[model samples]
Target: MIHQYQLNGYNIVLDVNSGSVHCVDDLAYDIIALYQTTEKQQIINKMLVKYAAVPEINKAEIIEVLDDLAGLKKTEKLFTPDIYQSKAFDFKNRSTMIKALCLHVAHTCNLNCQYCFASQGKYHGERACMSFEVGKQALDFLVANSGEMTNLEVDFFGGEPLMNWNVVKQIVGYGRKIQKEHQKNFRFTLTTNGMLIDDEVIEFANNEMHNVVLSLDGRKKVHDHFRKTFDGSGSYDLVVPKFQKFVKMRGDKNYYVRGTFTHNNTDFTNDILHMADLGFNELSMEPVVCAPDDPYALQEEDLPQLYGQYELLAQEMIKRNKSGKGFTFYHYMIDLEAGPCIYKRISGCGSGTEYLAVTPWGELYPCHQFVGDPKYSMGDVWQGVTNTELQTQFKLCNAYARADCQGCWARLYCSGGCAANAFHATGSIKGTYEYGCKLFLKRIECAIMVKVAEATLDSTATE
Candidate 1:
C-alpha cells in the first residue's frame, strides 16, 4: 500500500508495507496515483496529457520515472499486497482477560491548574474520594477477571491520587495480601501532582509502587504559568525540592518527571533542558489536548513551532548520548527498531480489551481520560464489564475501521490514534482530529529523522 502527501513544498510518498519513504515530483506523484487503478499504458497516456502544456514535460523522462517505480514494485518495495487487512483480529474472539487497570483513588486535588483536564480533580462531578471498601472490591474485580494472567498492573490515578493517601495505601496492602492466594502479582503505579508528596508518601510509593509519575511542567516559569495553586501562585518552588528529594530517595527505581506543553510554550525544549539541569534523568513532556478555543490549547499555528521543538529535542538527545550522559526522553525513545508491524498495530493498547479504568465509585471506563464521562462507562467493578457491545466496538475500532488511517503510513505506529482524543474531538472513537493528525505525522517524521541521524553516527564511528 502507498500513502502520498505534500509537506513543506515536497511531494512525499510512503510505502506502508515496506516502510520506505520517497520524495517525488508532481509528475511522479500523479503517475503513482493513476497507477493504483489504471493500466500502465493508460497511466502513462494520462500523465502525458496532464503535463502536455508544460515545457518540462518530456516523454522520455516520464517513462524513465515510470520504469523506476515499476522496478521498485517488482522488488516488492512499492505496491506491496495488503497482507495486514486479511490478518485483522476478530475482537469478539478475543479473550475476556483484564491485564491492567487505572484506579481513580482521589476525586479532588490540591492545585487548581488552569488547563487541568480533570476539572481540578472533581472530574466535572461532585468531589469525593474512593473508600477503602470500593478500593478493595476493585482489586477483587481485577483478580477475578484476570483470566489466568499472572502479572497484572494497577495505576493509582486521580485529580491527585495523593489526596486520598489512606485508601491508596490500603489498596496496595490489600493487593499484596491477595497476591499469594490468587497466584497473581500486582505491579502498582502512582501519578501525582507533587503537592501532597510528603516523606511518608514518597517512602510508601518507592516501597510499594513499581513506578511513579511526578507532574511538573518543565521550567519554573513555564510550569508555574499553567500548573499553579488555587491562589494563582507558582508551584515550582513547592514541588521541585520534593521531586528532587524523592528521586534521590527512590534511587534506581522506575519513575518519570512528567510535564505538559501548551500553546503558550511551543518552544518547550528549554523546559526539558531545565528538567535535565535539575537532575531528572527520566522525562516525559506531552502536548496538552484541550478545546481549540481555549487560550492555552495548541492550535494549527503552534504546530510548526512544536515540530521545530521536537527536532531541537532530538538533536539534544543525540548530543547527550554522544557525551556519555544520555537520558530517556519518552517521545524520543520510540522503538522503531523493534516496533509493532501492521498486524499487531490493528488493535491499540487494548483500552477496553486488556485494560480498564475504575473510578472512585467503582465505575469502569476504557482509560483515565474517560473516567468522568458517563457515555464511555463500560461496566462497574461488581458487574465486570457488563457492556460487551461497547467493548466490541472499541476492539473492532482499528486502522481498518478508519478511512483516513487506511492511507496513512503512520497508522501502525499510532494504532489509529487515541480513542479518548477521538471521542473528545469528534464525539466518536472512530474519529480523529485534524490538528492532532498533523501533529502526529510531524512527530513520526521527526522520529524517523532522529533514528536516521543516530544510525548514521553509529556507522561513521564504526568506519
Candidate 2:
C-alpha cells in the first residue's frame, strides 16, 4: 500500500509495507495515486485530457511515470504484500523473557492532579509505598525471568517516586550490587512530579539513572489548571524551579519534561514553546486520557485545532533547528533510515509478557496503566505471572490482529497503539480508539514533513 500527501511544498509518497519514501513532482504524484486502481490505458487517457491545456503535456511522459512505478513494484519496494500475519501467531508460542519492569515505588503523591490517570497515584486503591523488600524481590524477579538477555530496564514510577525517596535509593543500590554477580546490566529510570527534587536527588539520578522524566505541563496556567497541591493551590511555582535546577545539573544526561494537554488547552503548541523557552531541550506533551463525558476530554471539534497545532509545532521546530535553538519533541522523533525491528513494528509494547508493572504490594499488572484493574492482574513478583491465559491474549495483540489497523498507513509507526488506550476507549484490547488514531496519524505526518524539510535544508546548505 502507498500513502500520498503534499506538505511544506513537497509531494511525498510513502510505500507502507516496504517503508520506501519518494519525493515526486505533481504530475508523477497524481499519476501514482491512480496507478494501482485504474487501468493503464484509462490512466493515460485521463492524464492526457487533464493536462491538455499545458504546452508540456504529452502521452509519452505520462507513460514514463507508469514505467517508473512498475519498476518500483518489481523491486518489491511498492505494493509489498502483507507478510506479517502468520508471524503474529508465532508470538504466542515464543518463550516469555521478561526484559523490563515499571516499579510503582510510591502509590501516593503530594500534589492532587485532577486529570491523573492513576487517581492521584493511589491507583484507586490505597495510598501506600513499596517497601525496599518488595522492590528488591521485584528486581530479583526480573533477573530470574530475563533469560539470556544481558540488559534489563527498570523504571522507578509512582504517584511520585521521590515521595518514597529512601526506598528508591535502596532499590537502585541493590540493583547495582547484584548486577555484576548475575552478569546482567540494569538500566534504571525515574519519573516524578518534580515536587521533591533536591541537590542530592539530582546528583544520585545523574549518577545512577539511565533517564529521568520530569512532569511539568508547559505554561503555568495550563499546568496549574489540573495539577494542584492538597491545599487546592497550583504546584507550578513550587516545581518549575526545582525541575529547572535538576535539568541544569543533569548536563548531557537523558531526560524529558512530560506534560499532558486536555480540552482546556487544545492549542498545546504554545505550551510546548513555553517549555522550550524555559531551557528544557527535551520535551513531550500528550493528550489527556479521560472518559468521553469528562469536561477536559478532547472532542471531535478539537481535532482540527489539534491538527493545526501539530503542524505549527513541526514548522516551528524546523525554524528553531535552522537557527541552532531547536528542542526535541518526543513524538516528532522518527528515524526513517533505522527504526524498530519488524517484530517490534507489528506488536505493541511487550506489556503483560516481556514487560510488567510491579505494584507497591508486589502484585504484577500488565503495565502501570492497567495497575488498578484486578482482571488484568497477572500475578505477584515472588510467584511470577500465574495468569497465562491473559498473558497469551496480550501476546497475540499486534497490528495485524486489529482489523481496524490493517488498512492504516500509520499502523506500523504506532504498532497498533497503546493496549491500555484501546481497552479503555473500546471494550476490548483488540479494538481501536478512533479519536487517538486521528491525532496520531496527524503527528506522524508532521514528523515525516519535518524530517523532509531538514534534509532539504541541509542539502541546500552543502550546495
Candidate 3:
C-alpha cells in the first residue's frame, strides 16, 4: 500500500507496509500513483498528456519513471504486501508482564479546569490522595508482575501529584531503595499543574524524575479561559512564572509544556509558539477530548482549521529551525529510519497487558483515563489484575483487529489509535474513534512533512 501527497513544495510517497518514504519529482509522483491500478503503457500515456506542456517531461522520461517504479516494486520497497496481518493478535499468546504504572497520587486539584477530562482531577469520584502504604504496595505489585524486565516506569499523576507531595516522595524513595535488591531500575515521571511548584519541588524533580510534564495551555487568555482557580480566577499568572523557572532549572532534562486545544482555541499553534517564546523549548498541544455535545469538543467543521493549523505549525518549526530558535513539538518527533519495531506498532500502547494505572486507593485500571469506571476496574494493587476478560479485550486491541483501520494508511503510525479513546468514543476497546483518527492522520502527515523539510533544507540552507 502507498500514500502520496504534495506538501510544502515536495511530493512525498510513502510505502505503508514497508515504511519507505520517497521524495520524487512531479512526473514520477503522478506515475507512481497510477502504477498499481493502470497498465504500464496506459500510465505512460496519461503522464505524457498531463505533462506535455512542460518541455522537460517527455515520453522517454515517463517510461523511465515507470521502469524505476517497477524496479522498486520488485525490491518490495513500493506497493508492498501487508504480511503483518497474521501476527496482529500475537500479543494474546505472550505472557503479560507489567512494565509501567501511572499512579494517581492525588485525585484532588486546586484548579477547576472546565475542560479537564478527569473532571477536576477527582476522576468523577470523591477527592482523595494516595497513601504511602498504598503507593508502596503498588510498587511492590509492579515489581512482582514485571517478570524479568529490568527497567520499570512509574508516573506520578493526579488531579495534581504535588497535592500529595509527601506520599509521592515516599513512593519514589521506597522504589529506589528496593530497585537494587530486585535488579530493576525505576524511572519516575511527574505531571503537574504548577500550582504547588516551589524551589524544593523543582530541585527534587530535577534530581529524581526521569521526565516532568508541566501543564500550560499557551497564551494566558486561552489557558485562563478553561483552566481557572476554584475561586473563578485565571491561573495563568500563578503558573507561568513557576513553569518558566522549573524549565530554566531543569537544563538538559526531559520535560514538556503540554496543553490541550479545543473548539475555543483551534488556532493552537499560537499557544505552542507562545510557550516556546517563553523559553520552554519542548512542547505539545493535543486536541481536546470531550462529549460531542460539550461546547469545547472539536466538531467535524473544526477539522479543516485544525489541519491547516498543523501544517502552519510544521512550517513555522522549519523556519525557526533554520533561524536556530527551533523548539521541539512532541507529535512531530518522528524517527523514520529506526522507529519502534513492528510488534510494538501493531500492539499499540501496552495499556492493559503491560501498562496499567493505579488509583489513589490502589484500584487498577487499564490507564488513567479509565480510572473510576467500575467496569474497567481490573483489580487492586495488592491482589494484582483479576479481571482477565478485560485484559484479553485490550490484548486483542491492535491495528488489524479494528476493521476500520485495516485499510488506513496511517494505521501503523498510530497503532490503531488510543484504546481508551476508542472505548470512550465508540463504547468498546476494539472500536475506532473516527474523529480522533482524522485529526491524527493529519498530524502524522504534517509530522512527516516537517521531517522531510528539515532533512532536505538543512544542508542547502546552511551552505
Candidate 4:
C-alpha cells in the first residue's frame, strides 16, 4: 500500500510493500492520493480541469506524473497484492520451536529505584531466586522444543541477575554441557544493575555472558535521585567504578550501558553526552514506560521536549561521527536501508512464536516485561506452553489487525508497537500507545535526517 505523510516541511510517500520512499511536491502528492482512489483517466481529467486556470500548469508534466504512478503500480510498488492478508499466519499451525528464552533468574534487586517496574524486584510478590533445578528444566525444555534450530539464545534477566550469581553460573555450565551433547550453540546475555559487580562477577560475566547490559541513568544527580540503596543512598558512586571495571574486563564484547529517562529528565541529550564523555562506546537510553498517572511517567506534554532532545542527540551523534570517535546509540541504529519485508512487517518480533521468557519458578511468559503478570503466563517448563490460545493471541497481534496502523507511514518500521507496552498501557495486546507511536515516528524522522546529512557530507567531501 501507499502511505503518505508530511514531516519537516517535506511531503513523504512510502510504498509499503516495495519499501520505496519518495519526497514529492504538493501537486504530485495530491495526484498520487487521487490516483489511489480514482482511475488513471479520471485522475488526468480531474487534474486538467482543476489546474486549467493556472498558467504554469503543464498537462504534459501531469500526464508524466500519472505515467510514473502507473509504472509504480505495474511494478507492484504502489498497489501490491495484500500478501499480509492472503498469507496470514495460521496461529493454529504454528511451530512449537523455541529460539530464545529470557530467564528471569532473580526476582530480587539490590537497589530500590523509585520507578522500579518490578516493584523493587519483589514484582508485588515474594522476593526469590530461580533454583538450579528450575534453570536446568528450563534449558531442557528449550532444547526439546527448539527443533532444527542450531543457535539458541538465553538472556539472564532480573531484578538484578547478579543477586542470583550461583544459580546463574550453574545454568551457564549446564547450558554449555547441553550445547555440546545436542550440537546446538547457546548465546548468553546478562542484564544487571552494576551495583554487585566485583572482580569475581566481572570475570565470570566476561567468560560466560555473550553480552552485558549495565543500568546507569546518566549523571550522578539524575541517577542517584531515582536509583538508590536500601538505606536510600545514591548508587551512582557505587556502580560507576564497577561498571568501568566491568567494561574494561569485557573488552571488545557486545555490551551496552543502558539507561532509562523519565519525565523528570526530559532533557536527556546531556545524559547521552555524559555517558559518551565517560568513555563508553555503546549506549541506549529509553523513556520510562508506566501508567500515565505516575508522576515520573512521560506524559503527552513531554513529547515536544523529548523530540527536541532526540534532534539534539542526533546532531551530537553526527558531530561525533565526523570527529573520528563515533558511538552506537541504540535508537539511532535503525536499519531503514534494509528493513524487513511486508510478511515480516505484519508479524512483529515473533514474540510468542519463537521467543519466550522463563520465570524463576519455570513459568513461561511471552517476554521478560510480562514476567510477574500471570495473565500472560503461557505455561511452565514442565507443561510446555499449556495455553496455546494466549500464544495465538500474541502471534496474531500485529499492525495488520489494527485499524489505526493502516495509514501510518511508520507502521512497518515499528511493527504495531510493543505488545508488552500495549498490555501495560491499555490492557489489550492489540492496543496502540499514542505516546510510543509519536516517539517512534519522531525518532525515525531523525534517523532519516541523519542519513541525509551523512550523504550530503560524503558528496561534499568527494567534490
lDDT of 2 at 14: 86
Q: By the lDDT metric, which is better: model 2 or model 3? A: 3
lDDT of 1 by residue, 1-463 (tens): 7877653344667687776766677998998888779887787788788889987887787888889998989988788776676455564237578889999898888898889888898889988899999999999999999989999999998889988999999999999999999999999999988998899998999999899999989988899998888898999999999999999999899999999999888889899888988999899888897877899989877777888887677667767877877678876666755766655677666788789988889999998888777788899999889988899888787767777788777787787888888888998888886777887787676665556556545433212
The estimated TM-scores of all candidates read 0.84, 0.97, 0.98, 0.87
> What is the TM-score of candidate 2?
0.97
After best superposition, candidate 3 residue 60: deviation in angstroms? 2.1
Candidate 2 regions with alpha-carbon error over 4 angstroms: 458-463
Which candidate leads the pack in lDDT?
Answer: 3
2 versus 3: better TM-score goes to: 3
Give one clash count per candidate, in the order shown. 0, 0, 0, 0
lDDT of 2 by residue, 39-158 (tens): 999999998988899868699999898999999999988877778777766864485899999999999999999899999999999999999999999999999999999999999998
Top TM-score prediction, candidate number: 3
The digit string of per-residue lDDT tens for model 4 on 1-463 reads: 7767764445667676666767677778989888867887787788888888876767787888988878888987786655565344553135567889999899999999989888888777788899999999999999999999999999998889999999999999999998988989999999999888899999988998889999999999999989999999999999999999899888899899999999999998899889888988899999887778889999888888998899778777877888878888887786666756666676676677688988888899898778777788899999999988898887777766666787777777777888888777777878887788889888877776566556546423212
Indicate the residue-level lDDT of 27 in model 3.
Answer: 85
- Which scores better on lDDT, 1 or 2? 2
TM-score, cand. 1 vs. native: 0.84
Question: Over the full model, what C-alpha lDDT does candidate 1 score relative to the true structure?
Answer: 0.83
- Screening candidate 4 with a backbone cut-off below 3 angstroms (N, C-alpha, C), the clashing residue pairs are none
Q: List the global CA lDDT of all models.
A: 0.83, 0.90, 0.91, 0.83
* Reference-based lDDT, residue 78, model 4: 80
RMSD of each: 5.1, 2.0, 1.7, 3.7
